[model samples]
Target: MLNLKNYLCCLLLGVVFASPIFAQVPVQKNTFSGGITVTNNGISLLPTFTLGKPAAIFDFAVKSKRWSFEPQLRFSLEGKPWSFVFWGRYKVIDD
Candidate 1:
């Protein structure tokens, strides 16, 4: 089975790249996203025994014509730890 971190990385990359593919729909200035991740004995890449380790992720994005801000939260669904991430982006001389 794949490790949790690697699996989550791939999932996030997929979400980021897949956004433009849905361009036929109207774009929203604010967006919210969420997902669940699960793994077995591969949470930290070390050799340990764990089963059905699950986590939940929540993210929100605020977008304008030339700037964006995103904040994300991730926590264990099974009473584990949690973390938060924030991102800011701006367009500089878009062509």
Candidate 2:
């Protein structure tokens, strides 16, 4: 159930990472991120932890290259609505 933004971003990342031109280039080597989640019922769940029942959770991710991008995929455990978003970084940052 992947979304368009995820596919596109992953594709672009693959192209950037797989090309022989940047093969030897050593950019950022790693990433680490996590956030706390708050439920509408007034409960909070920290990352690496889980709530006993269905709850709203928010997540974030970052890509570290100069022209990097991040796409998010989200799903609901209740009504099961899903979505994807593309955000952060663009080629227009030519500075």
Candidate 3:
């Protein structure tokens, strides 16, 4: 199973490449965007079974130029933690 450390590494790599200091192309002004989603089951890529629990998922992002900082949070109705994912994205091609 993938661990938090592995995910962190990937996020870091993206952030490094997406830094404005290194980007050559012109980028748009900063923008804030986010949304919420409700799900019936909080399954984690398992083909066998599901959690069968109701969950609330939140996704938010701050974007500027060719880079964006997006973070996602998931939790059960009972206030239990499901998962947390953070993504740093860079636009390599704008076509």
Candidate closest to the true structure, highest lDDT: 3
TM-score of 1: 0.43
lDDT, each prediction? 0.63, 0.54, 0.81
Which lDDT tens digits does candidate 1 get at residues 30-91? 54454454444224323342223566556677767677888766567765555566789998
Q: Name every residue pair that clashes in candidate 3.
A: none
Best-fitting candidate, scored by TM-score: 3
Residue 74 CA displacement from its true place in model 2, Å: 3.1
Worst 10 residues of 1 by lDDT: 42-51
Candidate 3, residues 1-95, lDDT tens digits: the string is: 47888999999998987787776876557999999988888765454534578988888999887899999887888888777878999999864
Q: Measured by TM-score, how close is model 2 to the native structure?
A: 0.34
- Higher-ranked by TM-score: 1 or 3: 3
TM-score sort, best first: 3, 1, 2
lDDT of 3: 0.81
What is the TM-score of candidate 3? Answer: 0.60
